[model samples]
Target: MKIEIWSDIMCPFCYIGKHNFEQALEKLPFKNEIEVEWKSFQLDPTLDAAQPQNTIEYFKEKKGFPADQASQMIGQVAQMGKGAGIDFNFEKALIINTFTAHKLLHLAKKYGKANEMEEALFKAHFIDGKNVGDIEELVSLAGNLNMDKEETRQTLTSDQFDYEISQDIQEAKNNGISSVPFFVLNGKYAVSGAQPAEVFADALQQTYKETVSPFKDLSKEGGASCDTDGCSA
Candidate 1:
């Protein structure tokens, strides 16, 4: 079975969802056979990198939520984040455009360092309070992954991986994605948000079994599930 996740680098829920999915995959009998693809989705494509604002002010201003509500949401997410081994620095989290970071991921993917860079970016912004949108910080993060730092820096400044990133975002929109942490199980079964490990495990187990083509059940009326081998819906 193949699972594709469309998510933003800065989304707290995406990190949490990833944690849950990993935990779920760990328990599967066919875990080694499953292919996991991490696709990109940017929350703020046009954000100003030069004027990064604190994430708290961002939620309040963008959503019109009161400070107390925003703080409560942050607290809940932070506490959940601890289970995933990520410490979300809500107090210091900054909001910046993730366009460049998304571009960098495509570059990293080419070198088989996408997951490493993804975790590094998450830790940089949420745990270390690093400015993820800053080119310097991005280069430093890529260096930590043992990637060619100078090449990464040049890749960021040039229009190198923009096409792949653009295609990712466009595909997400075309697939009816409206939020981060959208899990496309076999390109059919989608579980949104930061679902728990047991829930994900159950879905994976179900998906693994349903991969067997259902030509035998020709009279079945219900539409093929997202997990079906040749799902048409």
Candidate 2:
């Protein structure tokens, strides 16, 4: 089974949800058979670097949520992350145009270091307070993962993996994605939101059952919501 996750690097819930989903997969019976492919979904495709606002202020201003409310939300998310064994320094986060990050991710995918690069980016932004949009930061991340720094820098500057990023975005649009942390299981089941770990575990167990017992019957299901357009058998 394959799990396709459409998520953004700067989205706190996406980071927390990633950890929760990973934990669920770790304990599932069919863990070895499942393959995870992280898809690109930029929360801000048109972020102007000139303004350069912090993430908390950005969300508060954009969503009309109070600053205190936003802080509480981030605090809850960080707590959830801690429960999942990941620490999220929501304070140090910056609003980044994730297009270039997505491109670099695809470049990392080519070298089979995609997961490492994703983890590095998450750490860089949410933990280390690094500027993920900068080429220097990206090259440093790639070098740490043993990738060629010069090649990574050139890829970031030039049109490297642009096509891949476009295609992934198009796919997300076709699926009617309106949020990050969206997950598609086996290209059949769609789940939306930063779901609880139990919800994610249930999803994997269900997918595993379908894979192991194809002839077994199943039924329509409904949770809080689906990732995009509603999922069916």
Candidate 3:
């Protein structure tokens, strides 16, 4: 079975959704048979990378939320992060454009390290509070994954993989997905938002069963059949 996840690295729920989805996969017997592909989505594509802003302030000023409401919303997200085993330091997190980071992810996908790249990006932004938009920081993260540092720098600096990011975003729009952490299983099942592990697990199992066994045997006894022999009943 194949699972394609469309998410924005800056989205808090996307991180939590990733954790819950992985937990769901662990509970499945055919976990090894599952193929997961990470797709890119940018919550704030027009965000200025040059001028990084405080997450709370961005929410208040850009999103039009009151100061106290912004703080409350961020606090709620932090609590949700804790529930998913993530220690989010929103105070240190900067609201920067994730376009370059998504480009790096496409490069990592070429090396079969997309999953690892996604996890590292999430950790950098949410936990360690690193500037994922910076070339140096992205190259460092790629190096940690054993990807070629110079190639990573070049990829980030140039317009490489920009088309891939655009395609992913266009595909999401085509699929009627405007939210992050959206999951598509076997190109048939679509699960949205930061759903619980049980929801993901059930979706996975149901998709797996249907993909592997699409037919139901309703007959009490075998009908006439032909194999190597001419015919048999």
How many angstroms is residue 2 displaced in model 2 relative to the true structure, after the best TM-score fit?
A: 1.0
Q: What does the lDDT come to for candidate 1?
A: 0.84
Best TM-score goes to which candidate? 3
| Model 3 residue 182 distance off true place after TM-score fit, in angstroms | 0.5
To one decimal, what is the Cα RMSD in angstroms of model 2 from the true structure? 9.1
The collision pairs in model 1 are 188-226, 189-226
lDDT of 2 by residue, 178-202 (tens): 8988999998898898888899999
The per-residue C-alpha lDDT of model 2 at residue 173 equals 93
Error of 3 at 1 (Å): 0.9
Our model 3 lands, by Cα RMSD against the true structure, at 1.9
Q: In model 1, where is the ten-residue run with the lowest total lDDT?
A: 211-220
What is candidate 3's lDDT per residue for 16-98, written digit by digit as tens?
A: 99999999999899999999999999888889977778888898878999889998989999998888888999989878999
Error of 1 at 174 (Å): 1.0
